[model samples]
Target: MSKARDFILDIFMPTRCPCCEGFIKWDKLLCEECERALEPVDNSNEVPPAGCSAAVSAFKYDGAAKQGIYALKDGWGISFAVYTAPLLAEKLKGCGADLITCVPMAKRKANERGYNQAEVIAKELSKLMGIPYDGGLLTRRTTSMAQHDLETASERAEFAKTLYGIADGHSDITGKKLLLADDIHTTGATLSECAGRLLSMGASDIIAVTLCRTVKEK
Candidate 1:
């Protein structure tokens, strides 16, 4: 019944590939060409940010992956979350997370955007992975400059520290293992800052996951 409904809807409101904006099957997230262009991340070389026990990402922040992320952020392709969650869920198999959470967006920014992309992905992931999700695990302290605007890693890290705090009534996560979700991983600064807050609140461990990550130049 749902598939029939989706097919009917596709006739009028066809699902476009998030990366290329080309018409695609109602059930597909990316066109074939865009899917082929994705570069998977090498998890063996991934280094978790301080306070996080592990970090995993599905693809390099380039090509189709970059466009897909941008699409989600700009509110054009929310279905990106439905496509990405399963991949991250596979990576997180055996990661014993008691709760799933996400990097918080400032209230002002969330209001303007009408949704937090990170939270959207996290909730989808929680449903797919069978984990409890807590959207209120953290809160943004201020509306700071966007992380992409920071050029250097040091600058990004410093600015991120001032952005997040444990959400009210979530002070004691005692012994809970958490999985943190976000749309992208650049310098890992924002995830690190959030993980630190969770650790300080007594979380036993944190595993961070993202849809894509910037590949550092050697």
Candidate 2:
């Protein structure tokens, strides 16, 4: 179970990078060069509210990171999750969360994709962080139009209401510090909507983390 053994095993198992499609080193989920290329989102200045003290993101949703996320989302490349989760975990240490919850896809998309990429990342991070993951605390009631295609923030947030946590009686989120994971954040509308829902559920704390955030154009 040495890192080198794992890397060799991974190569033989063919878990290559989705972007370059090259063999990834075992000790690193992705080649070190690629990791260095990713630009992490700096959230040091934003003063988040009580429940949402702050958020961290490992990369701007551009360049290699964008390519990696696209490959995973469009091509069903699961291997990308393996490498990306650690970067997220590193940003998340000491964030203070009791449980991990991911931004869920609408049932329609879930049925189509056969998986939720965010959920996959959250599960992987939960394992790495040794924290329990709560997959059922939220559920997407409906699918919204693709945010990328939309041009306005209001349109995006309006589209986001279709997503709602299934808060009937599955579990109580009250007083729990929750971490919400997503693949990308554009205008923060999507994350804000989900955070709003968590707050309504009486979630004591919420942290919005994403693998990447779409860099706004000037």
Candidate 3:
């Protein structure tokens, strides 16, 4: 039934590559050219966010990966999340996460975008990894400036400190190992802030994962 439904959807709305916006085979995530252009990251030596036990990211935030993330953020290509989740899941194998959650957006911002892309990715990841997903595990405080608007890592980190809070019904995460998902990791400020909040709520540990991470210049 699922395959049949997908076939029908593909017939009417052919799946396009999120990065290039070019037609792609229904089962493919990216056009061959775009896939070839992506730079896979080696995050083995990367440090985790301040309060996270570990962290992993699939691709560097450039070229194809950046475009795909923008498409999902703008609500144009949500399948980007579906396709990217598997890559993150593979990297996160043996992470020991009991529950999966995402870096939340403010209600107003989420309503404006129609959905939170991070949540979409986290939910898909939960299905693939056989972990439970809790969409409301955290909430973002309304803010005047978006994280990207902050220029420096220090500025982003300071702004992020007041950005997140534990959701009302999820205050007690005692002993639960969490997987925190996000679309991008630039300076690690936001993920660190979110992980700190979870840890304060008694979460035993957190593993952070993102679809893309900004590559530092060599």
Going through the candidates in the order shown, the clash numbers are 0, 1, 0
Q: Name model 1 segments beyond 4 Å from true.
A: 1-5
Model 3 segments more than 4 A misplaced: none
lDDT tens per residue, model 1, 1-218? 28889889999998898887899988787888988898989887898888888889999999888889888888777766677788889988988899999999988888888899999889988988899998877899655578889899899999998888878887457999999999988888999999998988889999889999889879
**C-alpha lDDT values of all predictions:** 0.87, 0.75, 0.87
Q: Which residue pairs overlap in candidate 2's backbone? A: 7-26
**CA RMSD of each candidate after superposition:** 1.8, 3.4, 1.7
Model 2 global lDDT (CA atoms, 0 to 1)? 0.75
lDDT of each residue in 18-98, candidate 3, tens digit only: 999999887777788987888888988778889987889888899988999999998877877776788889988887889
Error at 36, model 1, angstroms: 1.4
Q: For residues 1-218, could you state the per-residue lDDT of candidate 2 as single tens digits?
A: 47777767776785566655566655545666676777767767533423465776777778778878987897456666777788778878887799998887877787788889989888989999988998887777764557677788788777776656665675888888988888876677767777887888888878987777766655
Question: lDDT of candidate 3?
Answer: 0.87
Which 10 residues in a row give candidate 3 its minimum summed lDDT? 164-173
